[model samples]
Target: MPVWTLYGIRRGIATTSWPEKEGPTQPGVLGLPHYHADRCQDNCRACADVCLPGALSFESCEAEERLALDYGKCIGCQLCTEACPNDALTKSNDWAFGVRNRDDLIWTEALQSPPAEEVTRKIQKYFGRSLHVRHVDAGSCNGCESELQALNNPYYNLHRLGIFFTPSPRFADLLLVTGPVTYAMQGPLRETYNAMPEPRWVMAMGACAVSGGASGGGYSCGHGVEEFLPVDIYVPGCPPNPAAMIHALLLLLNRASQHVQGGQVAH
Candidate 1:
């Protein structure tokens, strides 16, 4: 038997005892949403109309002379917030949106602030003090890129966590790949990976990048990321909420155990 295969099998058995010993698993994704009433104008009902999943609704209160947002049905698209004439509604950087029950999806206000200090500490501990990332657009619809760009905003301030995105693959220590792997992108992806230096890591961000997602089995799809490159971490969800991306990046730095155990051993 080949040495690498034998070593892989042995390592698998030894690591199989992981979750049992590690603390309860952290969620792989998060989707926190926020509302800003101050920016809201009573005249705009665009949010109610634009919500594809019927997540947002309004109730007329004659006594209060205002409309109320139905927190339960909101899909966090932020379309309504963006469409509002008065700019009354706005979204926060918060992305830890989880609830015990399905009914908790609605937000009366922004959920609790993320543990910024704790996240910072974790990022520092995981990536070994300094980190540089190279981004690859495998085959995306550009939504993931939009959210990624937002990471540099004052609200998220990704740099504070010692994270930086490098324009050149040669300078990167981590590869932040987004989108499903498409036939056209296959060559570029491989070339980029080869360009990176040794001791590097790969983060497959978004559902498409992680598993082919909607593009999986599509005519143009190249199957999945694993077919092209070794993924050190998988961040699932369509254009994974930004916070989820942040958590996955942090996990890569910290060597957090993956959710799908032994599914894909890193090369």
Candidate 2:
């Protein structure tokens, strides 16, 4: 037998059984920020004032005052946590942040008064067993791309779940996209999406792809992937960890349910 083959047999399978089993956990992984409107100061705008990406905003309503949080625009800097004088905002440990609709990422105290509705997705009917993804870098800083590469490592072995990274969009069932959509790359990104077959899906993999991350509308970059394509899944992070990415993919296929809703743990 070859030496490499013998070594491989000795090492055994290194793949993780996450989403299916209680697998490896990242240390101190911080996810979506939780908001406590009741704790918000009467007339304070501390969080909004220090928000670098303008994700936090104040609105004056006829009967009540409200604070709105667009999670897509947040880069998870946690600056808002420190900025809030009333401790209204705090760090979240929940990281499985894939959602079926984009609207789920936006939250307001006024609107959250009503109970959240259950969401249904038809992706599993078409892509339950396996999925092929075609990735495109619209205009990334490479932070998102680096985390994506880790998905294939021994620790995460994304292929174990029947998910693969395909080179050709013609054979792809999903478009895994990263970065803020740049004006120059918009045409190419659309072309890739158009090349895919029917029953296709698109995933906005990072804060940049979700809502332009720290780089909002600039001279060269557009706001986010949704501005150019219909994104079916939104995974928010400066660059989401490998586990979070896996959760998003499984959620896209309907193999798993959303755990984070309106900045609170759902499941």
Candidate 3:
């Protein structure tokens, strides 16, 4: 075998144990909102006033009152918590943001699995314990695929998650696609989807695939991935960080159990 092939095999073995434990923190992990009251002179509304996303807000009262922090809208940017004059705000290191309802996101909670272990075991039973992925670049700036490729790098080590990318659609269990489906790429995208065997999966990665992204309104753009293929998972973000992609993949892996069942899986 060639030196690079040997290296790849050794590296693959070294990282194959990742799915057994809690994964590493993904890039851009959302942190908690922090507040500092001492540095805040009560008149400084910079945090709440400057929030463009409206994730933070404050209501003044005659007596001492705590500033309200809405967890739902908070992207975990410490902007408000950081802008306080009295150093009244500080974010907790927690990154889990699972919620029961859109309103349930008003507060924070521990991350819940869709029963990840059970799902993994089920997939292992059906798919024979390994995953083969094939990535398709429908139409993107290459940023999403850049990070996708980085998963094979030392830090992310995606193979540890029992994931492998294949070059041929015939050997692929999952079709990991990025970018918006452009007019020119439409036929190729459909052909790729058709080429995959039964019991196949499609994961739409990035905002472009989810909704045509920045090119949604463009005359030449094909609306979205859904317009061309059935997406088993929707990983939303302009170019979602690799960790987000990993989490989304894991989520899909966990849902492979449901994939064995009938309906569509939309995320």
All candidates' TM-scores? 0.52, 0.90, 0.57
Model 3, position 265, has a per-residue lDDT of: 17
Q: How far does residue 215 in candidate 1 sit from its true spot (Å)? A: 2.0
Highest TM-score: which candidate? 2
Worst 10 residues of 2 by lDDT: 111-120
Model 1, 162-192: lDDT tens digits are: 7899999998988888877888888999999
Candidate 1, which segments miss by more than 4 Å at Cα?
1-126, 255-267
Worst 10 residues of 3 by lDDT: 258-267
The candidates, ranked best first by TM-score, are 2, 3, 1
Candidate 3 on 1-267: residue-level lDDT in tens?
579977777766434334355554544454555443445565566777766545556655666644554443444446666676666666544433222122322322223323223423455566654678888898887878898988898767877667888899998888887877878888888888788887887887765676565555377776567788776666544466676566666666563222111111122
Model 3 whole-model lDDT (C-alpha atoms):
0.60
Deviation from native of the Cα of residue 8 in model 3, angstroms: 12
* Model with the higher lDDT, candidate 1 or 3: 3
Q: Rate the local accuracy (lDDT) of all candidates.
A: 0.59, 0.82, 0.60
* Structural RMSD, model 3: 8.7
By summed lDDT, the worst window of 10 consecutive residues in model 1 runs over 258-267
In candidate 2, stretches whose alpha carbon ends up further than 4 angstroms from where it belongs are 110-122
